[model samples]
Target: MPVVLSLNVARKTIPVDYARAGATGIDKRPVDGPLRVSPTEAKGTAGSGVAGDSIGDWTVHGGEYQAVYGYAREDLDWWQSELDVPLSNGQFGENLTTQGIDHTTALVGEHWRIGSALLEVTGPRIPCRTFAEFLGQRGWVKRFTQQARPGAYFRVLEEGLIGPGDEISVVHRPGHDVTVELCFRALTTEAALLPRLLAAGDSVPPEVVELVHKRSVVELDS
Candidate 1:
């Protein structure tokens, strides 16, 4: 059974001089006990958890579609070798550090029952300037994108409490065959995979479908 290895949240944003100057929510710390999870009420909405867990950039961070972010402990282990540094839970800015699950193979629209909350996989985490700044690695965005295992973003279907050690079980999986890794590849490295994304049908969010269509056009034109 997959389990929540750690529950993390950024109580407050940290200021940085890099592209993410004002404050970024990329810094997260593990915490014990149950933490509330809910969809962001509005852009820049904070305080969606029992603690002060909040999203820094409302324009692109927190929302109903990406209420929670999850990463695999296995991936962290792999990065630990590459970065030659001891990485801890939430080091990648994930709300849940999960164990015993292959996030890359996790399908979009798959439902996970964790604690009392129900979550649906929405898409893959696309590497961005904030993530690059957080990691502080040269060409981190491109490097991470090339890695092609961008974890998973989840939408909260049933708001509830979650905590470390909570068991996570798959309640449902959509018929779509598109996995999270495939989506990341389609979005980043391989334009040829864009048309294949539509095979997932409604399982893929409309916004992502739009991106896929745009990519498909560019792939054909190029």
Candidate 2:
């Protein structure tokens, strides 16, 4: 019944490292300042058009997904309020900013929209070293991740241009039994409890898939 919406999204001035290596075929142009640019630029293999796979567009995990990162309003407010900052200032490099939803409590496989782009909640972004760099704080990597609700990232099923000021709202919540919160709990408080959660066989990342495979009690496939 609640609607999840994106109020703001701040893409990294430096696109994800993988995106730059032509892995995602997204070119980088120093986001922010006069030279700020989006992550859609491709000047690599796709640039030559010789590669059969058209690597000039954003691809996730070698086409696993196009766009990979998102944030929710609740995460913003909690983090920002603690830091004493405004949510619109663009402190984080996360794209697909959000409003009206608490990503921490959101369920995996949930649906939402930003303009014409539809996104499904795939998983929580495992904090990378880059995220720490963005914060300009030592141990921020550990601190930020500890709070959970690291924000949602998705595999894009539809391709469309997304930018700031786009209104985001929820479309539906899948009837999956396992939820993102459970995954977060597994990753966080119940890290030692992973065997049980993975045994649940819910939505999770590929990296976790292997980890879960070993611990899964029942036959799990997804």
Tens-digit per-residue lDDT, 1-222, candidate 2: 333332222222233443333333222211222111122222221121111112223322222322445566567778787877565423454444555666666676666665556666666656545556545567876787677767765554444444445556677776555566677667666765565444433345555666665656443542
Question: Tens-digit lDDT track for model 1 on 1-222?
Answer: 899999998888887765443788888999996887775453245423334675667666766667788999999999989989898999999999999998899888899999999888878989888887778787989888988879998877887889999999998988878899888888888867877778777656667788877876886899
Score candidate 2 by TM-score against the native.
Answer: 0.62
Checking candidate 2 for backbone clashes, the offending pairs are: 5-99, 5-168, 6-98, 8-97, 13-31, 27-41, 60-65
- Can you give the lDDT of residue 101 in candidate 2? 61
Question: Which candidate number maximizes lDDT?
Answer: 1
Highest TM-score: which candidate? 1
Candidate 1: segments with Cα more than 4 A from true spot: 41-51, 215-222
Report how far off residue 113 is in candidate 1 (Å). 0.3
